[model samples]
Target: MDELFQQADRLSSSHIRDRIVEQLYKQSNQLIKAGVTFSKAQHNERTEKLDAIFTSPIFGFPIMLVMLGTVFYLTIAGANIPSSMLADFFGWVEGYLTVSFNNIGAPDWLHGVLVLGLYRGTSWVISVMLPPMAIFFPVFALLENYGYLPRVAFNMDRLFKTVGAHGKQSLTMAMGFGCNAAAVMSSRIIESPRERMLAILTNNFVPCNGRWGTLIILSSLFMASGFTGGMKSIVTTSVIVGIVIVGIMTTFLVSWLLSKTALKGVPTHYTLELPPYRKPKFFDTVVRSSLNKSLSVLYRAIKVAAPAGILTWVLANIQIGDTSILLYIVNFLDPLGQLIGLDGYILMAFLIGLPANEIVLPILLMGYLSTGSLMDVDGIEDLKQIFLDHGWTWITALNMMLFSLLHYPCGTTLINIYKETKSMKWTFWSFMIPTAIAFLVTFAVAQAALLFGWG
Candidate 1:
């Protein structure tokens, strides 16, 4: 024991420490074979398994993708009904608010801002955000409970190694599903400063729930056009899955770029241990992952989204120089927006939606509806009509999906990057890098469409 301690002290490197631990663990196992206690032997065996899987390159990455896809699928499919119900309830409330305000002779501006602008926006937030999160978080918690998440880290260890990041980034990326800010904070698990910064910088590429909502909505409405009946769901699901794949590819690309440039370093190894799959505690999984995580996210969305709704309503309703502030801003951005295969309103929505990516779709709907004053449309088909009014061709939808796939991190993610790196420079880069990629991709696509006479 003294020699093992001395060996550990003499070797300051992680590699040396790992080797010493390995040898000590092996000797402990041998002692157990010589009639040591069951508990002690089991403990040593567990440590060895942990060391081998975490440090091993094989069987790490495939597991990571599978876990990620499963979490996303659960969130995507589960959120559907709750979102619809929430929207219906909120729309019902909106009708009552209108009647009540009109009955009391409330000022038009105040009614518009509070009820139309503020309340409607909040409704969108609750309806859209609540259900999926309620579904996603608990399922996520279940995964965490069964200790599947650690195995993900174990499986992803090699990819992290090649990219000069800690294998534990798998866990942080998982956290990003809940919220990018939380994921960024989780980067503290990485001991290497450069790798930590790299993880922080590139973390935004993983779409949070807010971004996921936008992707899902866009895919379902626009990209699912080729299919009918039951096939539509499958096609839409495929599109959503494809968007996720793009996000992941983008993450790896950005991470690779960062490692070769500012945050360059050789990747460090990790010792991840896959815990035996435990039968998930059913109710606890629901309470912790599904209910708690969903509600927490919904609570945050309502807080941020309510104010944005009010602001958007105000901008839409207030007339300035024969156009509302919303129109004025959208008009100004139109040409640039058009170049990227989106309208000015879409561009403006993305700008305002910086605070929370989840709000981007709601904001875009607000903008589009404001143009036509279509304040009453509720169904997805109604949304399809609204897009048709705005000249949303299949090409337009494709570009929008592409833009959503590649856009900058939300306001929460930006703050997360700043917090994790503690550097405004890195945060700025994190924002700019993705935005640049989005613009370039969209621009190129639009140009190609025009050149081929597809527009």
Candidate 2:
């Protein structure tokens, strides 16, 4: 068996499988020409031309960048009015709910838990999550259904291979932009154990929907102080795309580091079948994406966040030695947080936000208010004001975005990681790798800003 395997290896060449595949297709074509009478598809030529441009060495990456930036820009801009409207609608409903609770003589804690905790959290998740996701998923789906995603993987395959990972990891990372848990599950596409693990561990570096919302707000701050009108959205999108690039770079770095250290192995090759690009039915694509990806994700987020809101409320209201349980946790973490250019509230938010990233900003706002109420701002203007009141500067905003980008997987994602790997040890490393990197990156930037007096 060993000698036979060695002989096969000696006879084989690089990309031998690809060559065999081509030869088989060529022979099949010959047999078809002799025995079959079917018209050749004209789209094959068209597809070849399209791939030539989309997969070209010169135009491929820039085109991909432009397409990606457009999707995100549309998502950011289109979501604004709808998100605001949803917030307003929810607030109106909350007012009526509050009146009903008061009329029913409900206890304050009961109202807080039911109305403020469960209902508010669920509504907030839907409002904030649904808008951007509604815009992003369908747009992304159009690209996918039209068969552009494979070209993305093709273009990125070499770079990932250079980092000792699979080319298909690019697709998983793209999935991460939607949800890291989904991305972690998507890593199953890469058959190599080492490469799949690399993909899973680094998936969090790609900001998920919740983190994207955080980035959008932070990126807007950069533009809010400067650019206006179209320039503002353009600049904001540019910053976000830049952050996305940063995340990709971090993915490569971590993948390479892990490949060299913990999971050292040779890279494996896999055949990628690029399907013919079909003009997708726009409305159908939108409907399917909305129902499958957007609504489902929103459902999961709300499920996780409602309980988180209850926990936050309980911690905020319950006091020990004149400090709320929430406050004590915040105070304990403040020094460490400050070392990373964040405050206690922001750090504690991330800890509690382990359950769902959707609740992080809300929890932070809750921590900021001494009234022990879960915070919900009316608009970005109000939210920005709250951050400013809390002494957040550009460094703070920058670090907050960075920390959010690099933090550990959300609770659902961590659970998915364990389930997928069925190994608690891998799950533990998946959590640790990102957390350590988040701290290191944020702490270094904070220290450097102080060193240069950026404040």
- Could you give candidate 1's per-residue lDDT for residues 283-340 as a string of tens digits? 9779776556777777777788778877787788778878899988988999999998
Write candidate 2's Cα lDDT for 84-144 as tens digits: 8998998999999999999999999999887777777677777777899999999999999
Question: What RMSD, rounded to one decimal, does every model reach?
Answer: 5.2, 4.1
Clashes of each: 6, 0
Q: Which ten residues in a row have the lowest lDDT in candidate 1?
A: 54-63
Best by TM-score: 2
Q: In model 1, how large is the Cα lDDT of residue 278?
A: 58
lDDT of 1: 0.76
Off-target runs (Cα >4 Å) in candidate 1 are 1-70, 228-230, 371-374, 452-455
